[model samples]
Target: MTAEQINDKIELCESAMDLILSEGSFTIAQLSEATGKTASQIYSLFPNKKAITEYYYPSLVIRYSAMIGEIEDFESYTISEKLSNFIFTTFDMMEDRREFVEDTFEKMVFKKGCNSEFHQEMTALFKHFFTTDGRIAVSAGFVMKDYFYEFIAREYLDIVKFWLNDDSDGKERSFALTDKLTGFVEEVVYNKVIDKGFDLAKYLISHAGLAKNIPLFGEWITSWFNDNEEENKDE
Candidate 1:
């Protein structure tokens, strides 16, 4: 599409969004009246009112990226600080439009195949962290793999949704919760709880009889017994 065409679509979507924000609900006719466009024109641009709101998601992501990109000292900030700023920035931007966002989210839940786009947008947002020199950051012996990105994205979305319903002064409750959850994940990753916990889970599952027919269960059981024997020997 041409830049002019894209700009026109964005303008139309923004007009539709404004209608949603003001009325807490909007129809294509309302949007047409607001934008001084024919209903057919609006329909050509967006199949339905919900699509206009869906368009807002990607626009928000772009605006969010630009907003954060302009931060003067972002690179100097710690991971927690960056994350906190990101969360609060989102809240700040959505403060006036929360109703529309909540409405769109509800519609998304009931609409098949719509949630994946939301997840993808979330994944993109979460990936802004751990980026150095325009690349994903890596530690001495660790890397932020795809699954890690997916996990953090989902967690971030969950926290944002919680924050929408949070009824605290200045959203202090959501801020505290975000901090605690971020710290908890850091602790788990740094302490190797993830690896050890998975090992323990496998051991438990092996003995739970659910894995009796699985070929790997026998070896897992043997390894568990051997490890216990070695520990006893050392003691």
Candidate 2:
């Protein structure tokens, strides 16, 4: 495709994502109609629905992050509350379109050998958040390390997945779980590390090493618990 055509198609795909967020779902035919192109044209650009999903996935995040930034600046909001609100509100805003996000998360981020610009962006985003003034107080002797930020980003994906699958208590279970985990980490940082004379940055980096992989481990344990619960029901 010509560069202009490719750009146009990208815009069309973005528009499709917007519609899906607003109206639940849209077919290639619908996208084509909206873009004043033929269905074949849409397919030529995206190849298939999965390609569309992949294209739309990062775009969705970029948009959501912009929206989150707007509400994130109120003095009344605690950092933890701000972060949680961003997560939940973005999820709610996603509505039925979250399947795409979940799919992208699993296939692109979590799966082995699935690394890309997307994964790096996520890691960097977390690192940036943690090193900033609102995050942890930087010291003159402190080195800007990214270890914990990477871990948090990886864990955040797992948390989102947990929230998505949880139908219990209107997904309050997932929300509560995330809040507890965040607070636990915060406490660990403040009392156990900061107040206790540990190197706070280094401690966070160490915690990152342990916590980043815990999501995958947590998944296994959750599965085991679910299986045992089912076995009990059967017996």
Candidate 3:
């Protein structure tokens, strides 16, 4: 959707949130009254309550994306730094609207209320973060990106759930969790470190002839050794 359309939908969500806070969850008639739109018009805007739920995160994601765009050196930031920024920025945005967020998040996402479209959007955004420009050059970038995307999506939801329940002063504990979690992920995903680790493990396993004792990967490792030997012979 175009920028204008996204803004419009976010505005609609904002209005719905106001109604929700005052009168508890929304009905079509309540939405109509809130937006000065008739029942039919409201239907055209939000086919059902779930549509409102669906639009919420994309609005947040779009806003986060825009916020990072204004950072002149965002491209220079490490994955850990970027992620820390993301969690903190998201929490900052949610601070004033914590009640609104809790009301919608529990009903919409926390209770398994998301749909395929929401997952798809989240996947796409995570893909952009992990693979965009020169951000993260994993050894097998394309091959492993979808797995990374899944990790990020799951992690994000888990963090949101943590935030919702956090009672620490200003949610400091949640911020600490973000720092530690993202730092660990950065070490694993940076450049070819993970690939090099796997390579070293394979070599050690083969060198010690220990693949036979390795159970699940024993046969595969034996074949892997044979293939490498054959390739060396051909050279």
Candidate 4:
């Protein structure tokens, strides 16, 4: 990429954020001002504000994934702590770009549910967490599916909404509640399965206990039970 291309990209993003927050729309002139770049330079990088927004979603996903990857790397940290810290770090990353992050998160969580790209990424991460640190937990018997997302969203909706509204409280409640619920899940998953060594997976497989229709917009919802031998490998 040209130096102007490389340089203006960040500015375009910052400007888009500032304009959206200050005014409800992101414009070329606003982005140019925010990034201290000439209009011609910006035009060369981005055709228009809509292009910036389009790029923002995928870029946001990549950035968010990296943040979650950090939480995943902390082997000593419990799942609950990692989750809490993840939420905190996430908000921090979106400090000035709060509106976009909140809107994207809410849309993925409640509106479109898991149909959105963000939710798909999150579900993949959760699946990875289970196969890794949570492997024993899963093998032992913690087979709850859809309820997990519902539980998390329900647990933090108000705090998240409040934080989006003002963010003056520094997201204290959101942090605390996320930590608490994650702890609860950790206990339910770890203590119940790892410590006790319950054969819940067997029951789940033999009986299809965790079966439910996953919400797919136009596609058939499928369940990923431990017994599905075909789904044992990566997709």
Q: Per-candidate TM vs. native?
A: 0.63, 0.58, 0.72, 0.55
Deviation in Å, model 4, residue 32 alpha carbon = 7.6
Q: How many clashes in each candidate?
A: 0, 0, 0, 0
Residue 23 CA displacement from its true place in model 2, Å: 13
Instruction: Report the lDDT tens digits of candidate 3 across residue range 43-161.
Output: 66667877875677666777788787799899888878887887788778777677877766765665552344444566676677667647454354535556667667778778988
Candidate 1 structure quality by residue, lDDT tens digits, 83-162: 67777777776776777777765456223222556567656666656544232222312446666767776777778778
Candidate number achieving the greatest TM-score relative to the actual structure? 3
In the range 1-235, model 4's lDDT, one tens digit per residue, is 7655544575577668667877888667667667787888777777776667645543443565555555545756666765566566556766657667666656534466545444555555554555556434654333646556544544444445555666447667656666677787777767643333224333433555332322341122123333344545542
lDDT score at residue 125, model 1, on the 0-100 scale: 65
Locate the minimum summed-lDDT window of 10 residues in model 4. 213-222
The pairs that clash in candidate 3 are none
**Candidate 4: which stretches are off by over 4 Å?**
1-14, 22-24, 28-61, 67-73, 99-109, 138-159, 165-170, 193-235
Off by over 4 Å in 1: 1-10, 27-45, 109-114, 133-143, 184-235
